[model samples]
Every structure is written in structure tokens, then in C-alpha cells.
Target: MNQTSAARPLVSFDGVSKHYGSVVAVHTMNLEIYEGEFLALMGPSGCGKTTSLRMLAGLEEPSEGEIRLDGQRINEISSIERDTPMVWQSLALFPFLSVQKNVEFGLKMRAIAVEERRQRARKWLERMEILELAERDISQLSGGQRQRVALARSLVTEPRILLLDEPLTALDANLVVRMQGVLARLQKELGITFVYVTHSQSEAFAMSDRVVIMSQGRIEQIGSPKAIYRSPASRFVADFVGANNILSGSITETGEDLKISTAVGEFHCEKNSDRDFNTGDTLDLVISADLVQISMEGPEVQNSLRCRFISEEFVGSIVTIFAELEDGSDFKVQARQRDLANMALEEGAAFFASWNAADAHLIGGNGA
Candidate 1:
């Protein structure tokens, strides 16, 4: 999420699609990754995020359309000729080679002079705080240290764009946080274009200037984390991007305030997108857990549902309340811990769950 205002795209996928026999891996993606920006491509397994990255890296060619870097098509380019270097999840360091040698491997392949390669490798190692481990064997290092080594190796080539394929997937929780900061800082200081691929929405939200959400080998939506979370373009985007509670129904009324009739009840809703939805059209209502409020006495808001409190989970500063509607549908509410204390909730106790109409997002489409 670096400074990308008025930025030109460093990479472009123009009607790009990939096929393996009868299987369609990626289906005609049209996207642009701006220079000096952290762009994340996120989705489930086999959704073509890694396939897109591989195509950009020249590891795999697109079956249709063109992939361009700086407006120049590179479909026929070799991996070595492309300026995009990737940090793989496995790291892929040479087991027998020293840290310094591993970091300098790319330079060696390009036939850089040995002395200059050592100097550059040492410089990057120093930046990664692993200069002391330059002479150490790959097997002698810890997981975090190896991750840094992989980062240094990818960055030592001074690529114009850095492609990351879930490089932090192997780290522990704390290490993952630390590496996230490391990656963010490096991207900021260097101001290089980054195309990251991951399945974690939190990671994408925390690091990227914009997130590209994919589903079933096609792009669902592309927007900032805030935009995507607050106003998802489709039911799939809403479900995949966050813990949003969705209700299926048909439009009973439409105007400044839309209304949907569902099994739970009729809910007043607000449009999340600019698309026009008519009366009787199928609709999916998305409500964030935090937006759902609870009252033991009675309904305090417009859209209200009466349900029994099933359980409560306290996680750090937030508390999650799980409940079941009269129709037996699961419902959840997230609130501050202090707020939960005010409710004095008990299991199996009937309560009113409510939310403001402004907080409910109406999506006129089918769900995931």
C-alpha cells in the first residue's frame, strides 16, 4: 500500500485465461497492478491466484490473451528475462549452499562477477539482519531465519516487481506478524510494485492498497479493503472477504430504502452497490457481526430478530455471541467485552437481536 497516486500499471492481464485439458484454471482476467503498490490476489485453493502469479513470472504461459509489463507483452519471454522475482512459500533455498551463496544464486546464474555478487549478497543479508549467518549452512537456520534468507534471495536481484506466493504461510502466528511488518517496511522504503497472492483476507486487508477477490477462476471484485468489506459487489465476495451474516430473500419493496422478505422476517436494507435491483428480484442481505446489537428487554432498532442466546465466546477485547433464530438459523453478534457485561447474558435465554438499516448491505444476487 505504498505511494501509488497517479501511478501507472507495472503489470497488466488483458483477457488472460489458462486451461489444462478440459479444466479452465483462469478465465479471462482483465486487471492492472499499479507501480509502487502492494496488490493482493486472494481466494480459495485452485482459484488461479498462484496460476496468475506464475504466468506473470513467465513460469507458465497464458493459453489465451496477453500479459504485459510496462505495456510490453511478454507471453513469449523466458523466466530469466522477466524482471519479476518471486518469494515462494517453500523458500526453495539450496540445502547444501551457504546463506551468502544462496542469496547470490540469481546473480551467479546471470554470470555477475564473483566479487560484486558477494558484496551485493552481503549488503542484502545485512539489511535482513542475517549478515552473521552468511557463512552458515541452510539446514543450520531456524524457520524465521530461513524466511529472511528467502526474502533476501528474492530481493537481491533488485527486481522491478516482487511477486509473493503465500511466503508467510509456514510461519507461526507471531513470526507471521513480524514478517508482515518486515515486508511492509521493505515495500515502502524500496517503492517497488508488489503482486501478492494469499487466501487470508486479514493479511490482504492489512498489507495491500487494493485487493482482487477471485472465485471459481474468475474475478469477483476488486477494491480497497475498506470498500470490499463495507460494500461487497457480490454474495461470494461478502462471504469470502469477512464473517458477514447473509440472509436470502426476495425484494418486497425498492426505493430509497429497500425491503426484503426472508425466513427470519422482513428486513429493511440499504444498497451496497450501484446496480439497480427491481421488486421480486432475489436478494442477499449482508450484515457484519459487529453491527448486530442485542437487547435483553426489547427491540431498540428497526430490523430486529428475537432469538435465544446459545453461547458466548470471549476473545481478547471482543466477545462473540452465538444465537439461533426462531427458524433455527444460526446468528452471531460481535461486541466489546464491556458491552457484553452490560447484557448479563445467560444460555437459552430469549433476547432481541437488532441492527440499523444503514449497516445492512443488500446484494441482489445468488450466494456462494
Candidate 2:
């Protein structure tokens, strides 16, 4: 919350890499995790997210590079000795143990006095809103309740860093939403560093201060969710972070702003980052389907293009219209039903799709 104090990262991954014989689980990872920040590592399966977390937890050693915590190197630190606690997906609570006992398991292992451990466990259980179930058996608790108990168990020790590995995957959708809020509030209240791993974009965007999008054992991009979504650094990130219609195009002009010529038309794009582009350069443009608007009649808009409606998909509040350009290239546009009703569109109908120049992002290479 306080940017001044949070300027310095609490954990730094300096050119870290981990290899398993012929396989590279993590390839030259370099990252800075700020203190009290909730950072999420997101990617598809086998993208080194779990491997990276394992290396941080000292469960696996990096074949190359170093890991630092609070300015001290922690690559050699053992899992139990490090000033961090991990919450596994399984909850890992003993089936026969009461909620209170399960929550205090770590403290007891550390040789804390029984009374002190109970006091701490009770405090955390109450904080997690599970005090009433302190004596309930783990098997009797619901998925959400078990998750809270596991969190209380981890937080009871008051670790400076918390590592969560898809801790909400087992919960239902409604409960997952509820837990996302809980985790967000907990991070703000505790002011502790949290490194979370998940494959869910909604979860990462909803709860993280910054998101690290990983792909094939490497980081694709690292930034706030908005930046990552709006201005992805690479094609992989652009496609992964959200719904995008990736188009192949060439740069017809380059200067103060970029002008790309695609199958549909030549369009101008906002210049935010220093991306190299020149006339006749090939590039990719990622435009979100939701950002485009469709109308039966063409609007006098700069980026508007005429297309034929191929199909329509009704999804809750918005309808996704699939359309094809004169060149036979297809893209999707999402509009509310009321907006579509205004157009009175039909299948195989002619329509114009348009978006702001600023809404399109240039990726991959200079559009030629």
C-alpha cells in the first residue's frame, strides 16, 4: 500500500534456473517480489510455476542462479528454517485432529509452550472466522472451512512470507470468489509478502498486485494486471492474459504513431512502449473482442471495417458475433443484447465492426 516502503523487493530471483537432467523446469528467471505485495505466478501446466515456487521454498535447488530474501541469499536455506510458510492445495490437515490442534500444529512443532500455542491458534482461528469450529474434526468441515483452517494454521506462525499453491482450486465457484476477497483483505491487513501460484486468470487478476505470466518454463511478462492485459509485452502474454483476437499485419507507416495494414484495413495504434517498427515490418496486433462494436450500418469511424456476420453466441449479458472480412479473415465482436437489438442484426447480415486505435496493441515485431 505504501509505495515508498515497498520500493525495495523482499525477494529477488537473480537469473535463477532449475534443470532436471535433460529438462529445464525454470530457465533464467529474474524477478523482484516486493514486501507486503500479493504477487501471482500464472501459466499453463508444466510452465515452471510450481518448479519456481519449489525452488523458493527450498524443496528444489536451482541448477543455476541465486534466490534472495530481504537482501540475504536464500538459495541454500532449508524449507523449515526459512522465514516463510507454504499452504498446499490439499490443505494437509490431519483428519483426526481438531481444528484448533490442526491450526497449532506448526507452533507445537517449533516447541512453543502449549498455552502460548493455543492462544496463538485461537487468535488466528478467530481471525479466520472459524473459532466456533475450533473443536470440529477436519473431515466434518466444508471445503471452504478447511481452506480457512489451513490458512490459519500457516498464519499462526506469523511468517513474513506466505506461499500459496492453488489453495482455492478445490472450492466451488461462489466460495472461490468469496475466498479471493478474503485473501485480498488478509494481505492488506497483515502487510506480508504473498507469492501465489495459479493457472486461473480471473484469480490472478482479481487478487494480485502484479502478475507474472509464465510459459514453457519462462516468464512472458510481469506487471500489474491492467498493464499486462492492456499492453502485453509479447504475443504469448497477449493471448494468455485475456480474450484477444490476434491479427497478422504489416506496418504501412511509422513515426509518432504506428499505422498497421491488416487484411481488413490500415489502422493507427497508440504508442506507449518503445517497440521497434518500420515500414513493411510484419507484426501481430492483439485486440480484445469485447472492445469492438458492431452495427448494421457503418459508422463514420476511423477504424471501422465492413464484415459479414457468420454466427452469434449469446453469453449472459453480451452476445459474441463472429464475422468475416472481405478477405475471409474472421474475428469476434461482443455487444450487449440491447445494442445488438438496436442494429436488428441477422445471420449472414452485413455489419461494420470498429474499435479505437488506442485499443489495439502491436506485438511480436515491427509491422511492415
Candidate 3:
């Protein structure tokens, strides 16, 4: 657990479920949201990430269990009084209103004085670095400018927590990166909790202090970006995270270094003390693509497989080589583009892919 998990949670969903008729949107979820931490709920569409965010925002009421805010039961509380403001994907800016007016809309609803609302709006606009655009009409501003307006509007009341549901989806690729930095810096500076929902893996892993992976209305895994990427807790997590090769195998021996027999060949991995494995137990091992090395000759590694080159994908300086293992299972190796060029690997060429036994992580077992 990190420092955030050690502290008392600012918001919590205890055995929470949201259902409509016979269909379940969220099912029996227990999660804690720490104060001043950026927590991202990520998954595929219809995975209930948005619904979870809505429940926290008081936009949707849970059919079962409780939603709490600052140790107070808030399931029955109204959205306006919850102190949880939401920034929508559409930005939802008023086209008829100027930039400053759009930001002051939230304050005005709270019955704050007109002068005070104007001052607060101006202050936030300056903080967002859009003070010069305060007087411009909403239609005259760019997408990024309007996003700032939406953020200022949601934050004008100075709420304790902010809810964002794919607020950066409308921006272009470059703008999304810029806004990620903006949001990360703003959350750190304000020291307030941010519960963000998105389907993009890059967006979630790039900015979140911790990530919640949900599938079919159930929580799959919750951990820091590095933890989820390097050591997935389950096969579902390993597959959903991508760039990982999960090999099905059965334990042939058990000790400090367990030997597992798979279709490709025999492999060994350091035993996880948390799990107990007996001989003949079925399990899965996760190997990150970046950890696998490809060589023209078999390397001196604990785990090595002869694979046939299938194809390669290039993303700037990084390259991903796809190959088929002896068992016909797909494997991948990620390395520098220049380094791979030296090998001059060709389609259908045979090569050895190897990795240290310590790099393999185990999942699934009788005591997993």
C-alpha cells in the first residue's frame, strides 16, 4: 500500500450496486478514494466505470448499499449539496454565454453575491491561464479554451472533489497530452481528490496515481500504474493491460523456484509467498513484452523459446516484433528500432526469445 491507501479514504463505495430492472450496471463494489489523489476508473465501454463515477457525483442513486463522502452517508444527498462537481465529456459550456459567465454559472447557482462570483471566476480563469479569453464568447474560443472554461465552472465553487468523465476525449492527440499535464498539475497544486473516468489506457496510466480496472460491472484490479503493468494480479488483468504474454501451464515442481511445464517448453519463476502451489496445479504466467529479448542465437537465459517471426510494429523509436512460439502461441518483443535493424529479422525467420526467470510473474493457483 502507498501513502494514499494508508490514509483514511475521503470517499468510499461499500457493497454498492446499481441496477435497472433486471440489468445490472454495477455490482457489489467496495472501493476507497483517498484525499488529494488522482484515481482513474478505466475499462471498456459498458464496464460500469462511468456509472461508478455517476454514483459518486450523486447523479445516480445506488439500488443497494451505501456511498459515503468524508465519512458521511451521502446516498440520499442532493447533487448540489454534495460538494462533488462533475466535468462532462461534452464540456457542456453554454454557447450563449461568455467564457467568464460560463465559469460563474456554478457560483451563481449557489446564491453567491454577484461581485464575489465575478472575482472567483476571474481568479480561476487566471489560474487556468485563460484570463484573456474571459470576455470572449464560447463559440469564438478553441476546444482547449472551452475545456478550461468547463474546468473553471466546475471548480468555481471550490469543491473538495472533482469528477471528470472523459473530459479530454474531444481534444486532439496533442491537446490531450497538454491537458493531462494541466489536470495533473492542478490536482497536485490544489491538494483535492480527483476521480477520473476514461476508456483510454494511455490517459489513465499516464496521469493517475492509482488505476481501477473494471470488467462486467466488477472490479478486476486496483493498483499503481507500475504495479498493474509489471505484476498483474489475474489473467484478465494481464490480458486487458495488453503487451503481456500469458502462458497456460501446470506446475511440475514446487520450491523457491517453481518449474512449470507449458506447451512451448519448461519454464521457472520465483515463487510468490502469498500463493501456495501443489504439483499438477494449473496456472498462468505473465511476461511483459518489453522484458523479452530476441537473438539470432539462443541466449544464456533461464527461459528461452524458438519462435518464428510474424510481423513488426513501429512507434517512433520503439519497435514491437510479433512472433509465433513453438506451441503456435503469439509472443511479442519490444525494443529499440535501431537495435532491431541490426538483426535484419525477416518474416518467417526463426529466432530465440529469452528472459530471466525472475521476470515471469505467476497468477492463478489453488491458493492464489
Best by lDDT: 3
TM-score of each: 0.94, 0.94, 0.97
Angstrom error at residue 130, model 2:
0.6
lDDT of 2 by residue, 1-368 (tens): 44475388788999999999999999999998988889999999999998999889889989999999989998888988885788898878889899999998999989999999999999999999999999999989999999999999989989888999999999999999999999999999999989999999999999999999999999999999999988888888877877777788888888777888888788888765665667888888888888997777789887888888888899788888888888888888888878777675677889888888888877877431
Give the Å error, residue 164, model 1.
0.6
Q: Give the runs in model 3 whose Cα sits over 4 Å from its true position.
A: 1-6
Alpha-carbon runs more than 4 Å astray in model 2: 1-6, 255-257, 274-276, 366-368
| lDDT of prediction 2 | 0.88
**What is candidate 3's local distance difference test score?**
0.91
Looking at model 3, report the run of 10 residues with the lowest lDDT sum. Answer: 1-10
Descending-lDDT candidate ranking: 3, 1, 2
Give the winner by TM-score.
3
Task: Assess the local accuracy of residue 168 in candidate 1 as a C-alpha lDDT between 0 and 100.
Answer: 91
TM-score of 1: 0.94
Q: After superposition, how far is residue 132 of candidate 2 from its true place, in Å?
A: 1.1
The stretch of ten residues in a row with the least summed lDDT in candidate 1 is: 1-10
Better by lDDT, candidate 3 or 2: 3
